[model samples]
Target: MAAVGIAVVLGLAALLPTAALPCGALQPDNTTASKLLGTWLYVAGAAQFPQHLLELLLIANGHLQVEPGAGEQELPVPQRVAVGDQCLTNNSTYFEIAVGNTTLVKHAKTHQTVGTLMNLSSEDVLLIQYQLQRERTYLGLYLYARNLNVSTERREELERYAKCLGLSEEIVYAPWKTELCQVRDIEKGNSPCREPAAVVTASPPPGTHRPGSAGN
Candidate 1:
């Protein structure tokens, strides 16, 4: 069984495209920025890199709450994800809207990820093509929606978009069976499902403001 699993992984890695294909970009503007506000549930994801694909496989379900930050260009994103039996929460990362509809997210001041909003057929769905740099470049696509129940047509659309980006058709969907972390519990710092060791909290940079603060 172990050998078969390794073989399957290696086969998938070999199928990855060496270079990413061109895809339509969503121009960043006030209208687009406003659309990003509020809560979004993680529906599905696809990736060109094997490591990122593995990361997507681990997420059973997740959601993100976006709020306006101190600056107009900054968006504070509070994220919660369920992995296996553990729930992980992070409230420090911020997404900055950059030129060309691209968003920059800094993770613990360690590695920066650049994500470009992609044009999707459905207005209710948001598709982001992202590239993360660490030792090497990793490319992936994230699909978020206002509601958790996604249609079959939407899933098909995502598969087509993934193919256009030179990513394999094997998209991973977060199971809806898992309950999302409650906002009230998160605010009170007493979520029942939250794993103590998995909790990640950090202060915003000196000039920035945290979500739900008066400065926001």
Candidate 2:
């Protein structure tokens, strides 16, 4: 976990700016900034989801990065990418997500609201809803823990949220079985990638590739 923290912090610093304004109307609100600064594991999603299974994603310092996973039942190895994020307005209800690497990683830029749920209910409990559009689109509502383990009550809370959203049982699954996953430190000992000077103005809506690859 300590390693995860160090890696996440470094990644955020290397990739994100203080305030990212993709559109001229976007603002720098700290409400979402305060709530979204930490590591989030991918616990569950809609059926036919596209993100890497067992993947741990971190949101910090107004940036987003991928914690590479050990792959799922079929995926042998998973790839990752870094992202820059910012609030859409002062209210912090909406956020913008852009790919850190355009050539190496696929960018999800077709939509403006990459993150729907960013509030932290407790120190350890974070409930979020986002959309993923690959060839097809799917909604991902996830419960994230600050650490690897969460209370049973917290788990139930996530389930309740899933049910409330009308997510089917078969589509929802917790990818983490043990403690926090052992993930690749994407920011450790690597040359800092070039940060985008201005936010991307054209692309498809933000979406992630499936469990095996980082997207086409």
Whose TM-score is greatest here? 1
Candidate 1 per-residue lDDT, tens place, 140-199, comes to: 788889887778888888898899878867898877666545545555656645323221
Summarize candidate 2's per-residue lDDT along 84-157 as a digit string, tens digits: 22211011112332222111122223223333443334655555554333333444455555564767677666
Off by over 4 Å in 1: 1-21, 49-54, 98-111, 180-216
Q: Model 1 — which ten-residue stretch has the worst lDDT?
A: 1-10
lDDT of 1: 0.58
Model 2 deviation from native, Cα RMSD in Å? 14.9
Instruction: Provide TM-scores for the models.
Output: 0.68, 0.42
Candidate 1: residue 16 Cα off by (Å): 18
Candidate 1 Cα RMSD (Å)? 9.3
Provide the overall lDDT of each model, using Cα atoms, as 2-decimal numbers: 0.58, 0.31
Worst 10 residues of 2 by lDDT: 1-10
